[model samples]
Target chain A: MPESSLRGALTEAVLYILLALYTPLHGYGIMQKVDELSHGRVNLGAGTLYGAINTLLDKGWIIPLAGEMDSRRKEYVISETGKEIVAMELIRLQELLDNGRVVTGGTV
Target chain B: MKHIVHKAYWDYEKEEQWLNEMSHKGLALEDYSWCRYVFRDAPAGKYIYRIELLDKTGSHYESQKYLKFLEETGIECVAAYMRWAFLRKEASLGPFDLYSDIDSKINYYSKVINFWNIFAAMELVIGTMNVLIGLVNGGRYGGLGFNFFLGLPLIGLGVALVKLGDPLRAKIKRLQQERAVQE
Candidate 1:
């Protein structure tokens, strides 16, 4: 599995998906988690979610759990590399937040 | 009770909407093959329908797996024809969509556009080749050959298919610009 570059800002969907996979989840579970995490603001359609999951799997950011293939639905969890990407994304997001605060002169 | 309707659809979105409208009229889509749709009686607005062009044909292993995944998500594969699958979810499951974000929508459109463009290009090439062959053979026989007549219609069909992709290409351009600014 190839690792995608971690330099750019992750899309909102990718970030939420990585966050969602902190715990093992199947395709539907991931969708539900993303919806809940965004407070229903982000509703992932089945096709889109499927595409994202496959991309994540290909990028080695997520891996299917062992012994879950007996059933039709397979479970996936975030990989070590995925966690590292998430950490970088957090730092990038924090920088953006800090810059926003400085520019707007609003303290939070 | 089974009700069958023969309809031709050039646009999948329009087909989806028409299927949904049928569902609202108590006709739930049961199966689809070519221009034929089989419907069963159900309550009005009982189901919401969606159509997608799979990366492979319906019988292919990958498409079957994808359909299985969709079924696990409470979306049912109502029918499969060629590379197209018709899916429906219970209307009560809130709103159902196959693409939630702009990026995925653009990706879907790209797939569609690519399919049409390739198909149309093949038609154009074959049609042009047939026409040229017919013309050369006609000059030898002192009249237009049958191939010439056949090729004329094929070329027209190819041109129409290309024209059909125009709006989708425009839609992709607009979405790309939107993504550039928003993302």
Candidate 2:
């Protein structure tokens, strides 16, 4: 895993999605999880969700789980690489918050 | 009761809005083929409608998979024509939007603009070629060949398509600015 490539901050959607996939979730479940986690602040539309899922799969950050042959509801779980990326993101967010408080001389 | 109407719309957003309006009037879109829309009576404001252009034909495997994914999310494809699909969801299912983020919206606009640009370029090229052929084969001052006349409308259509893409480009610009600030 290249730390340099993951240095950039993940978009809100991608970060939320990766967080949501801590447990295996299908498409609709992922959408619901994101919505709930964001407290309804983020709504993942179908098209955007589809595109993001494909991109994440291509990057190997997520792996689709095989279900029944007749089942169209494909589920996914975060890969080990994805967990490392999420950990980095957490550190990055903490830095942002710490920086804000230090500069403002007040708790954020 | 069922009602059928023939209409043409170059803008998918406008078509979507029009379909939503029809739903408000208790006319749910049952099917669509080309410019014809078939509607059936239903409770007013029963469904929300959306339309999108696929990168491939509706029958293509990729497109079908995409549609199937949407179905799992509770959206149904009412009809598909050429590369466009008419989608609908129950109005009570919260807000229905195919693109919820600025980046995705911009991506969609880019796709539409690219399609139109290609169409416009093809029209302009064919039109210019025909005009040149007509002028060279027929006299320049008079007796313009049939190709010259045939090319005029094609050129006009090309220009029209370009003009139509301008607003979408403007939208993309605005969305890009918004993304820069927000994301």
Candidate 3:
């Protein structure tokens, strides 16, 4: 039931975060990646990032790195589920970009 | 130079805005205690202040972990009061918003409602109890007029809390409906 909700649906912040976590990324690193990924267009706030991280973790889309426990600085990686979401999101984005190019006269 | 500003616990948005306004006037928050805020002279437009209310109670470890996380993002914790944490960052680092998305914003609003609803309920409960006891005892304690007057303020405050919850709950519902449609 919950899996159905993950179909083609993710917030912009969550999409960027999943895209950024192709490799292990720390909290701060995720923020930087989002900023870099968006080209400084979408500023991810600390609180919003924290909330998104928690939500993804709850959804089993991301997992905490082992041996980092006992310390507040934890790292995360996109799980298999998270990767699937990323793939879905990428296809969705590709279609959007394709439409833009087609409508905007061959420019994306 | 220093300025002391007093604000209630429920006025966090106003407090954040006021702190930002002060920073714009070349005054950065040095410290604050209770309702009084202490500010010192600093370069104008150099800092951005943010506040987050801790939702969990009696969890020092959780709060510390949150603070540590904020530090990693270049936001430094300057002060903490009860469940509220005050954080600051150099504006030169660019703009930062605490809750950007609707769902996250709803989470924040729910936390606030949890805190204030409990407070307001307690006030109303005590106020009613005092009036009832006073009425039963009659002149043995304070006069009826005295008890009524004393309870009046508490009742008024409880009404204020109820008013506060109405807008917040409506916002939560609105966000939930919008999210439902999108999903």
Candidate topping lDDT: 2
Docking quality of model 2: it rates as high
TM-score of chain A of each: 0.90, 0.89, 0.85
DockQ of candidate 2, scored on C-alphas against the true complex (2 decimals):
0.89
Question: For each candidate, what is chain B's TM-score?
Answer: 0.95, 0.95, 0.85
Error of 3 at B96 (Å): 1.8
True lDDT of residue A81, candidate 3: 91
The superposed Cα distance between candidate 1 and the true structure at residue B177, in angstroms, equals 0.7
The candidate with the higher TM-score, 1 or 3, is 1
Model 2 reproduces a share of the real contacts of 0.94
Here, model 3's chain A TM-score works out at 0.85
- TM-score list, all predictions: 0.95, 0.95, 0.83
- RMSD of candidates 1 onward, in order: 2.2, 2.0, 3.6
Q: Candidate 1 chain A: minimum summed lDDT over ten consecutive residues — where? A: A1-10
Tell me the deviation in Å of residue B171 in model 2.
Answer: 0.5
Candidate order (DockQ): 2, 1, 3
Q: Residues B125-153, candidate 3: write the lDDT tens digits.
A: 98887777667666666557456667778
lDDT of 1 at B145: 80
